[model samples]
Target: MKKIFILSALAFSLAAVAQNQKQAMTKPKTTPNKAVVYQVFTRLFGNQNTTNKPWGTIEENGVGKFNDFTDLALKEIKDLGVTHIWYTGVPHHALVRDYTKFGISNDDPEVVKGRAGSPYAVKDYYNVNPDLAVDPAKRLEEFEALIARTHKAGLKVLIDIVPNHIARKYEGKTNPAGVRDFGADDDTSVEYKRDNNFYYIPGIPFQVPTSDTYKPLNGEKNPLIDGQFSENPAKWTGNGSRLARPDINDWYETVKINYGVRPDGSKDFPQLPEGFAAKEVKAHFEFWKDKDVPNSWVKFRDIALYWIEKGVDGFRYDMAEMVPYEFWSYMNSAIKAKNPNAFLMAEVYNPKEYRNYIHLGKMDYLYDKVETYDKLKEVIQGKTMPDPISDIQNGLADIEHHMLHFLDNHDEQRLASPEFAGTPEKGKPLMVVSATISTSPTMIYFGQEVGEPGKEDAGFGTHSRTSIFDYIGVPHHQRWMNGGKFDGGQLSQSEKDLRDFYKRLLNFTVSSPAVPSKFVDLQKVNREHMSYDAGLYSFARWSDKQKMIVVANFSWLKDSFFELRIPAELIAQWKLRDGNYVLHENLYGRRHALLKVVGGQGTATISIKPSESFVFTLAD
Candidate 1:
């Protein structure tokens, strides 16, 4: 009788424990820290040249190498709260420099853009850029070492994967055994083949564009500049131009890769079955296990896998929407199969295809340039009101976590440039809003924090965006480089202050647990109650244990104080005791305030400086 009673009591205890564990699992989980990406043009990060002459040769203007990212440099980046280092233009792209002595084939001058050539015009898939290596013969080895070092620094690596097109001259010299070069097995006789690598314009010869604004070698004479690139049957341009000679403004230096997409706007391969959007990466991989994709899809998949195997953590697919989503379904699934936590982001612009790419294609993130960055730019430029930010957040509420926000990138103008906000200080408010707006990742160009205006007139590249096709120097960023000491010895006081602000903002976002939690927009409520103007925007981010009120004053010249009102509904939802509470400021630690709540309504008087932002955290 005693044994039976003991067994029954133990069974009851086990059942109660199981019930408690099940309830715990059903509760909502707290979100972790958001990702902060630091994008650096590998060829420009370490260059200390001030000579930014138009079309300057590498001998005249210096070029940065992979070895430049020493341990100290990476540690400095990590200290800035960066989680990933996006090394742009790391592959072996088309360049004017001759590497013939290294057994590499020469690229035609007529078909190449700029003196250094466009980074998007890739030459070899399995090799690194010779210009980015101290010794051209050991470029690949050096790149592998860089990848290893990046991993050792506790930072993930992201490199570009331009799948929509490739350089006019595509060769796989360093490919592994049994790996064939693109177009090697392709049939050039047919214009449209499901298996063909490129679209052909039969019976037509490739011609260089006749533009008065551009010269093959910037009017510099060269033996290779014959004004003719021999292609019996010309291929379509990278921008989908089917002309034998593409327009100068088009992507004339690159040829589009055909991934079973016919010229008639029809697909040659099988499309995803219905309801595939509801599946996971594993299911997607299984669905395509016995399937046959196009040869181009396989080639790109192999390319991505090659980098992933080389210790590359992720890929930023260039113009991802230009390629079919089906190919992404196959390629990204294969990548996930290899590394489930791979960071797969893409440059997808179409809002219509956003969910399809994220859900069905298994992309981890996409460029938020159109909805988030563009709206933020409008507010900064005084072209639009700040009210749209709330709408943008609501519109993308479902996939806000998958949109990556940024103020500057290679394709956009620098914040300090005259073409942009005309000063880096204007970016302070913008950075705060962009970073804390959603659960999305935030990125910044290498020199953006130090105010690299990119005013240098690089050949074949103009103002606004940084030049990815020339040997030019970034003036402001060089000061921070400090002659490769990886210190800010030469930075001005104001520049140092700005960098400090960026460090604080990024580090806080990456370390704060409340950032990825619930977000409540205070714009509408503050606009009505506090008499806040269109130049001011406010929002609240909170978790069970922490809360923050973010306010950004976009006014270029106005400084004012306003009563920040917390709505009664939110107060009730938070279940806070109506009493006096102290709030601590995150930016400037000296700013603290007392919050007064009466009958479920809370209000705090806060002062904001002109073109400044305040991140206030609730303190117990």
Candidate 2:
């Protein structure tokens, strides 16, 4: 009788515990991910010229360093029609770890080619890159100011949040956090420990601007940090490559955001599965929960909150796919909960596979390359799309769900790169038409518009061209959608007009609704070409209240054409004047005209010019 009572009581206790855990695991609230994200590699995107000089350049000259967010620049981004701006690599790159070879330093650069590294190599967490921000307090304040301005202009802000890695370089002899040297023994509570078996000459960039950058303690920089800058370069370390993976995860947690996974595969914190008294599991969670805070995911949330507090709308996660989807879902949701209208996006090169993550509702967008390749191939092959525009339409739809759609990002070869296109100038048109009508949230990278020649070499082989601060081969004129080099009197008019033409198309996407809205549909025409009944490349979109048809000629030498026949049901619904189909068809000399015939088909006709994309739509 006693044994039976004990067993029954234990069962009841177990049930109670299970119910408590179930309640703790409430589904996280989320918002719809619908943002047109603009991804900017701050270093590459900005004006930093360090050509031929041995040292990094911080030009006090013209159009060089943007201390303040110019209305001209803001207007340019806004005019492009993007819903949000994702500024990447915003931390200070004042520390020139390289070019110490001959003697030149950051202060005396004869000319540093570009800006800083792609912003992924973070030297400090607190400040914006000086190359990008003229004044730390001022610039940050201005950045927030710009956020307010951008929103006023109908745009949002999304800065890059790198919770994964840090710059292999450092500024000042003092390591990050102002400690002499951090070791496991110095602070057992320290989540990461250096192996006694190894020695480390910590990476510390000498000139990280205090006014513009945060300073971490020693042993805190990434393994990739430039050891060459030190007296005994090789002696320093391989960005802590010797560090353990679990320790790496913990270090990343300290270094960035919510990265390290619980040893027992549970969430970090008071939130954990019941009965997790396992010593190792309990030990890992307890250590991180109490000791690790610098690189807390809450820290990432804090940074975002800081931006939002400062007035920038939000942030875009760099290489978001690498991080757990739950992290994004958490941060993104937290952000919206704080600001109902903030915009967020992720740079997952592909969106389909990441649906599980994206659909959970924190990532607002992703980078879409499917449309990129397909459109490029289409133009180059001179092939017409078949009915349903399956690839194009579906690609856009997927992006719409995740805020994808772009011409080029900082990580890959520029569409204008010869490897992708035959030459720089050849791929300009391909970039323009493809990105303009793409249903994904569209954005053009910094150098993409002008086809910056460094796309392939900028960050190739061993750690992407030394410094993003080194501005090499950036053009005088914007080369994004169209045009090329501009001389005083030579090719100036043509180049200017061509540039303006791209601007108009970009603006059209932003200002007009027909191109990106979900109402458009694709229809099968003939095997010769795929046709849309409405929107860009569409034959027509019709209903009782409105009618629209758009056609573009994507070929240079041939007269491209398509037809849309308005159905009799639609005509009856619209109550339009019934037209004799045969007469209109015969008179038009083309089967492509809306004609009310016996077949109840009012055929619509379309003709497109080489590389031309147009929209035709009418709605009440």
TM-score of each: 0.94, 0.62
Once fitted onto the true fold, the runs of candidate 2 whose alpha carbons sit more than 4 angstroms away are 1-56, 59-63, 80-83, 93-115, 135-155, 168-258, 262-295, 350-352, 370-389, 395-399, 421-439, 446-469, 476-491, 519-523, 528-557, 561-598
Q: Report the error of model 2 at residue 525, Å.
A: 3.2
Off by over 4 Å in 1: 1-32
Candidate 1, residues 277-375, lDDT tens digits: the string is 999899999988998888999999999999999989999899999998889999999999999989999999999999999998889999999988999
The top-ranked prediction according to TM-score is 1
Q: What are the per-residue Cα lDDT tens digits for candidate 2 across 66-137? A: 433455566666654456777766654434334343232342111111233335655545556554545433
RMSD per model, one decimal: 10.3, 18.3
What's model 1's TM-score? 0.94
